[model samples]
Target: MVAEDDEINRMLTHHQLLDTGLVLEFAENGKVAVEKARANRYQLIMMDIQMPEMDGIYATKAIRLLPGYAEIPIIAMTANVFSQDRQVCLDAGINDHLPKPVRTEYLYDTLLKWLEK
Candidate 1:
Protein backbone atom coordinates (compact mmCIF):
# COMPACT_ATOMS: atom_id res chain seq x y z
CA MET A 1 0.00 0.00 0.00
CA VAL A 2 1.21 3.54 -0.79
CA ALA A 3 -0.45 6.42 1.02
CA GLU A 4 0.35 9.74 -0.58
CA ASP A 5 -1.66 12.85 -1.39
CA ASP A 6 0.54 14.39 -4.02
CA GLU A 7 -0.16 13.15 -7.51
CA ILE A 8 3.40 13.66 -8.71
CA ASN A 9 4.86 11.67 -5.86
CA ARG A 10 2.31 8.96 -6.36
CA MET A 11 3.13 8.72 -10.03
CA LEU A 12 6.82 8.78 -9.39
CA THR A 13 6.54 5.98 -6.89
CA HIS A 14 4.35 4.01 -9.24
CA HIS A 15 6.99 4.21 -11.92
CA GLN A 16 9.70 3.37 -9.44
CA LEU A 17 7.88 0.28 -8.23
CA LEU A 18 6.80 -0.83 -11.71
CA ASP A 19 9.48 -3.44 -12.21
CA THR A 20 9.32 -4.86 -8.69
CA GLY A 21 6.42 -7.23 -9.51
CA LEU A 22 4.37 -6.09 -6.56
CA VAL A 23 0.68 -5.36 -6.94
CA LEU A 24 0.37 -1.88 -5.54
CA GLU A 25 -2.60 -0.15 -3.98
CA PHE A 26 -2.80 3.62 -3.50
CA ALA A 27 -4.53 5.93 -1.03
CA GLU A 28 -4.80 9.66 -1.55
CA ASN A 29 -4.85 10.38 2.15
CA GLY A 30 -4.32 8.71 5.48
CA LYS A 31 -8.00 8.02 6.11
CA VAL A 32 -8.23 6.10 2.88
CA ALA A 33 -5.00 4.38 3.71
CA VAL A 34 -6.44 3.15 6.99
CA GLU A 35 -9.61 2.05 5.28
CA LYS A 36 -7.66 0.08 2.71
CA ALA A 37 -5.58 -1.49 5.43
CA ARG A 38 -8.70 -2.59 7.29
CA ALA A 39 -10.05 -4.23 4.18
CA ASN A 40 -6.91 -5.88 2.91
CA ARG A 41 -3.59 -7.33 3.94
CA TYR A 42 -0.45 -5.86 2.42
CA GLN A 43 3.10 -7.14 2.89
CA LEU A 44 4.32 -3.62 3.46
CA ILE A 45 3.01 -0.07 3.48
CA MET A 46 4.83 3.03 2.22
CA MET A 47 3.13 5.90 3.98
CA ASP A 48 3.51 9.62 3.52
CA ILE A 49 3.82 11.65 6.69
CA GLN A 50 1.92 14.75 5.64
CA MET A 51 -1.53 13.99 4.31
CA PRO A 52 -5.03 15.30 4.70
CA GLU A 53 -7.93 13.57 6.51
CA MET A 54 -5.32 11.97 8.76
CA ASP A 55 -1.57 12.09 8.85
CA GLY A 56 0.69 9.09 8.55
CA ILE A 57 1.50 8.96 12.22
CA TYR A 58 -2.14 8.70 13.25
CA ALA A 59 -2.88 6.29 10.45
CA THR A 60 0.01 4.12 11.56
CA LYS A 61 -1.21 4.21 15.13
CA ALA A 62 -4.72 3.34 14.06
CA ILE A 63 -3.50 0.56 11.85
CA ARG A 64 -1.35 -0.75 14.70
CA LEU A 65 -4.48 -1.16 16.80
CA LEU A 66 -6.26 -3.16 14.15
CA PRO A 67 -6.32 -6.89 14.63
CA GLY A 68 -3.59 -8.76 12.73
CA TYR A 69 -1.71 -5.57 11.97
CA ALA A 70 0.53 -5.14 14.99
CA GLU A 71 3.49 -6.71 13.27
CA ILE A 72 2.83 -5.42 9.77
CA PRO A 73 5.60 -3.18 8.49
CA ILE A 74 4.56 0.48 8.07
CA ILE A 75 7.34 2.73 6.81
CA ALA A 76 7.16 6.49 6.69
CA MET A 77 7.89 8.05 3.29
CA THR A 78 8.34 11.71 3.98
CA ALA A 79 10.37 14.87 3.42
CA ASN A 80 10.57 15.40 7.17
CA VAL A 81 14.06 14.22 7.99
CA PHE A 82 14.77 16.05 11.16
CA SER A 83 15.79 13.99 14.18
CA GLN A 84 12.63 14.94 16.06
CA ASP A 85 10.42 14.08 13.11
CA ARG A 86 12.07 10.68 12.88
CA GLN A 87 11.55 10.19 16.57
CA VAL A 88 7.88 11.09 16.23
CA CYS A 89 7.48 8.44 13.56
CA LEU A 90 9.18 5.93 15.85
CA ASP A 91 6.91 6.85 18.70
CA ALA A 92 3.94 6.36 16.41
CA GLY A 93 5.07 2.82 15.58
CA ILE A 94 6.47 3.31 12.10
CA ASN A 95 9.04 0.62 11.35
CA ASP A 96 11.32 2.83 9.25
CA HIS A 97 11.65 6.23 7.58
CA LEU A 98 12.32 6.87 3.92
CA PRO A 99 13.21 10.44 3.20
CA LYS A 100 11.48 11.97 0.21
CA PRO A 101 12.50 12.64 -3.35
CA VAL A 102 12.82 8.93 -2.67
CA ARG A 103 15.90 7.62 -4.38
CA THR A 104 15.36 4.37 -6.24
CA GLU A 105 18.21 2.50 -4.56
CA TYR A 106 17.20 3.43 -1.04
CA LEU A 107 13.59 2.65 -1.80
CA TYR A 108 14.47 -0.83 -2.96
CA ASP A 109 16.82 -1.33 -0.05
CA THR A 110 14.20 -0.26 2.45
CA LEU A 111 11.61 -2.50 0.85
CA LEU A 112 13.94 -5.45 0.92
CA LYS A 113 14.96 -4.78 4.50
CA TRP A 114 11.37 -4.73 5.74
CA LEU A 115 9.62 -7.15 3.39
CA GLU A 116 12.29 -9.78 3.94
CA LYS A 117 11.32 -9.75 7.58
Candidate 2:
Protein backbone atom coordinates (compact mmCIF):
# COMPACT_ATOMS: atom_id res chain seq x y z
CA MET A 1 0.00 0.00 0.00
CA VAL A 2 1.10 3.57 -0.71
CA ALA A 3 0.18 6.46 1.62
CA GLU A 4 0.93 9.89 0.33
CA ASP A 5 -0.67 13.31 0.35
CA ASP A 6 0.75 14.32 -3.02
CA GLU A 7 -1.40 13.38 -5.98
CA ILE A 8 1.53 12.91 -8.34
CA ASN A 9 3.48 10.84 -5.87
CA ARG A 10 0.58 8.54 -5.16
CA MET A 11 -0.33 8.17 -8.83
CA LEU A 12 3.23 7.58 -9.96
CA THR A 13 3.96 5.05 -7.26
CA HIS A 14 0.69 3.24 -7.86
CA HIS A 15 1.31 3.01 -11.58
CA GLN A 16 4.90 1.93 -11.17
CA LEU A 17 3.89 -0.74 -8.71
CA LEU A 18 0.96 -1.91 -10.79
CA ASP A 19 3.08 -2.22 -13.91
CA THR A 20 5.55 -4.32 -11.98
CA GLY A 21 2.93 -7.02 -11.35
CA LEU A 22 2.41 -5.83 -7.81
CA VAL A 23 -1.10 -5.09 -6.68
CA LEU A 24 -1.39 -1.79 -4.83
CA GLU A 25 -3.84 0.54 -3.15
CA PHE A 26 -3.43 4.19 -2.21
CA ALA A 27 -4.52 6.45 0.64
CA GLU A 28 -4.52 10.22 0.43
CA ASN A 29 -3.62 10.74 4.07
CA GLY A 30 -2.53 9.00 7.22
CA LYS A 31 -6.13 8.58 8.35
CA VAL A 32 -7.01 6.67 5.23
CA ALA A 33 -3.79 4.69 5.48
CA VAL A 34 -4.68 3.42 8.92
CA GLU A 35 -8.08 2.32 7.67
CA LYS A 36 -6.63 0.52 4.67
CA ALA A 37 -3.93 -1.24 6.69
CA ARG A 38 -6.50 -2.44 9.17
CA ALA A 39 -8.72 -3.75 6.44
CA ASN A 40 -6.18 -5.55 4.29
CA ARG A 41 -2.83 -7.26 4.33
CA TYR A 42 -0.10 -5.81 2.14
CA GLN A 43 3.30 -7.23 1.26
CA LEU A 44 4.77 -3.84 2.02
CA ILE A 45 3.70 -0.39 3.08
CA MET A 46 5.42 2.76 1.78
CA MET A 47 4.66 5.70 4.05
CA ASP A 48 5.10 9.40 3.41
CA ILE A 49 6.46 10.95 6.58
CA GLN A 50 4.84 14.31 6.22
CA MET A 51 1.08 13.97 5.75
CA PRO A 52 -2.19 15.42 6.90
CA GLU A 53 -4.29 14.66 10.00
CA MET A 54 -1.94 12.02 11.34
CA ASP A 55 1.71 12.06 10.05
CA GLY A 56 3.46 8.85 9.07
CA ILE A 57 5.16 8.24 12.38
CA TYR A 58 1.90 8.35 14.27
CA ALA A 59 0.19 6.27 11.64
CA THR A 60 2.96 3.71 11.67
CA LYS A 61 2.83 3.52 15.45
CA ALA A 62 -0.90 3.03 15.32
CA ILE A 63 -0.64 0.43 12.61
CA ARG A 64 1.92 -1.48 14.63
CA LEU A 65 -0.51 -1.64 17.52
CA LEU A 66 -3.30 -2.95 15.31
CA PRO A 67 -4.01 -6.62 15.33
CA GLY A 68 -2.10 -8.69 12.76
CA TYR A 69 0.12 -5.81 11.57
CA ALA A 70 3.02 -6.47 13.92
CA GLU A 71 5.26 -8.07 11.31
CA ILE A 72 4.28 -6.07 8.21
CA PRO A 73 7.21 -4.09 6.85
CA ILE A 74 6.55 -0.32 6.97
CA ILE A 75 9.12 1.79 5.18
CA ALA A 76 9.20 5.56 5.51
CA MET A 77 9.39 7.74 2.38
CA THR A 78 10.09 11.43 2.69
CA ALA A 79 11.73 14.41 1.03
CA ASN A 80 13.22 15.43 4.37
CA VAL A 81 16.78 14.18 4.16
CA PHE A 82 17.79 15.07 7.68
CA SER A 83 19.37 12.34 9.76
CA GLN A 84 17.24 13.32 12.76
CA ASP A 85 14.03 12.83 10.85
CA ARG A 86 15.24 9.51 9.51
CA GLN A 87 16.14 8.33 12.99
CA VAL A 88 12.76 9.39 14.32
CA CYS A 89 11.06 7.35 11.62
CA LEU A 90 13.02 4.27 12.63
CA ASP A 91 12.13 4.87 16.26
CA ALA A 92 8.47 5.06 15.30
CA GLY A 93 8.17 1.51 14.05
CA ILE A 94 9.33 2.01 10.48
CA ASN A 95 11.24 -1.06 9.40
CA ASP A 96 13.27 0.93 6.92
CA HIS A 97 13.48 4.40 5.36
CA LEU A 98 13.62 5.62 1.78
CA PRO A 99 14.23 9.19 0.75
CA LYS A 100 12.16 10.62 -2.08
CA PRO A 101 12.17 11.25 -5.14
CA VAL A 102 12.32 7.48 -5.17
CA ARG A 103 14.08 6.00 -8.15
CA THR A 104 12.45 3.02 -9.85
CA GLU A 105 15.37 0.75 -9.10
CA TYR A 106 15.59 1.83 -5.46
CA LEU A 107 11.88 1.41 -4.91
CA TYR A 108 11.98 -2.06 -6.41
CA ASP A 109 15.08 -2.79 -4.36
CA THR A 110 13.34 -1.78 -1.14
CA LEU A 111 10.42 -4.04 -1.97
CA LEU A 112 12.66 -6.93 -2.83
CA LYS A 113 14.74 -6.45 0.32
CA TRP A 114 11.77 -6.81 2.64
CA LEU A 115 10.15 -9.67 0.73
CA GLU A 116 13.38 -11.56 0.26
CA LYS A 117 14.23 -11.32 3.96
The model with the greatest lDDT is: 1
Tens digits of per-residue lDDT for model 2, 1-117: 889999999888876687778777888889999999889988788999999999999999999998888888998889977999888998998998888998888889989999786
Compute the lDDT of residue 106 as modeled in candidate 1: 98
lDDT for each residue of candidate 1 in 1-117, tens digit (9 for 90 to 100): 999999999999999999999899999999999999999998899999999999999999999998899999999999999999999999999999999989999999999999999
Off by more than 4 A, model 1? none
Local error of candidate 1 at 93, Å? 0.4
- Write down the worst ten-residue block by lDDT for model 2: 14-23
Against the hidden reference, what TM-scores do the models get? 0.98, 0.94
Per-residue error (Å), model 2, residue 53: 1.0
Badly placed stretches (over 4 Å) of model 2 are none
Q: Model 1 Cα RMSD, Å? A: 0.5
Return the lDDT, model 2, position 73.
95
lDDT of each: 0.95, 0.89
In model 1, the Cα lDDT at residue 28 comes to 99
TM-score of 1: 0.98
Q: Looking at candidate 1, what is the lDDT of residue 88?
A: 99
